[model samples]
Target: MTWLLLAGAIVSEVTATLCLRTASRPGAHKGWRVLVGAGYAAAFAFLSLALDAGMPLGVAYGIWAACGVALTAVASRVLFGEPLTRVMALGIGLIAAGVLLIELGAAH
Candidate 1:
C-alpha cells in the first residue's frame, strides 16, 4: 500500500509540474491549473504516507526526481510536440547516471 502511495505521489507530482508549465502559457487552461494544485496536494499527502511506510527519504526522492525528468521529456515530445534536443537527452542521461551512483553508493 505504501509503495502504491509512493508511486501515486510521484505520478501526481510530475503531472502537477507539467500542468503548471502548461498553465503558465498564454490562454491558460483553468482546468489544468486546478489539476496542478490538486495534484501537488495529493503528492505531498502520499509522500507522507510513503515515509510512514519506512521507505528511505533519499531513495524515494531520488527515484521521483529521476523519473520526473525522464518521463517529462518523453511526454513533452510525444504528447505536446516539444523538441527532444540532443542536449536535453544528454542531461537526462547524466541525471540517470547520478541517480544510479547514489543508489549504488547507498547499498553499502
Candidate 2:
C-alpha cells in the first residue's frame, strides 16, 4: 500500500511537471494550468499518505524524486520532442542507481 501510494505520488508529480511545460508554451490552453495545480496537489496528498503508511521519509522521497525525474524526462522527449541525449540518459541511470542504493541502505 505504501509503495502504491508512492508510485501515485511519482506519477502525479511527473504529470504535473509535464503539464507545467505545456502551460508554458505560447498559445497554450489556460486550462493546462488547472491540471498542473491539481496534479501537484494530488502528488503531495499521495506522498503524505505513503508517509502515514509507515514508509521512511528518506526512502520514499528518494524514489519519488528519482522516478519522477526519469519518467518526466522520457515523457517530455516523446511528447514535446525534447532532446534526451545520451548523457542525459546516463544521468537518469545514475539517478536510478542512487535511488536503489538509498533503498538498499534503508533496509539494513
Candidate 3:
C-alpha cells in the first residue's frame, strides 16, 4: 500500500537524519558515514515509490517532513541526549496538526 511505503519513507528519513547527527559528532566512526549515505538513498527510493503509487506530492511530502522532524527530534533526545524544549515540542505538534489537515483535505 501507498501508506506503507510512505511510512517506510518516513522511518528511513528519520534514521538517515539520526545517522547524520552521529556522523557529525567528534571522533565518529567511519561506518556511520556509510550508514547515513545508504539510509538517505533508501529514504528517497521509498519516497519515490510512495509518490508513484498515486499519493499527491503535497500530502505525501507534508506528512513525510512533519513525521521526520518529530521522530528525529524525539530520537535525538533519547539517543543523543539532545534537548527537547517546550517551544520545539509545540512546533512539532503544530507540524503534526498541519499534516493532518493536509491529509484530511486531500481526502475530500
Ranking by TM-score: 2, 3, 1
lDDT leaderboard ranking? 2, 3, 1
Please list the C-alpha lDDT of all candidates, in the order they appear. 0.85, 0.96, 0.93
Residue 28, model 3, lDDT: 97
State which candidate, 1 or 3, has the greater TM-score.
Answer: 3
Greater-TM-score candidate between 2 and 3? 2
Badly placed stretches (over 4 Å) of model 3 are none
Positional deviation of 58 in candidate 2, in angstroms? Answer: 0.4
Per-residue error at 9 for model 1, in Å?
1.7
lDDT, candidate 2, 1-108, per-residue tens = 999999999999999999999899999999999999999999999999999999999999999999999999999999999999999999999998999899899999
Q: After superposition, how far is residue 37 of candidate 2 from its true place, in Å?
A: 0.3
TM-score of every model?
Answer: 0.81, 0.97, 0.95
lDDT of 1 by residue, 9-77 (tens): 889988898898889999986998999999999988888888889878997788777877788888888
Clashing pairs for model 3 are none
**What's the TM for model 2?**
0.97
Comparison by lDDT, 1 against 3, better one: 3
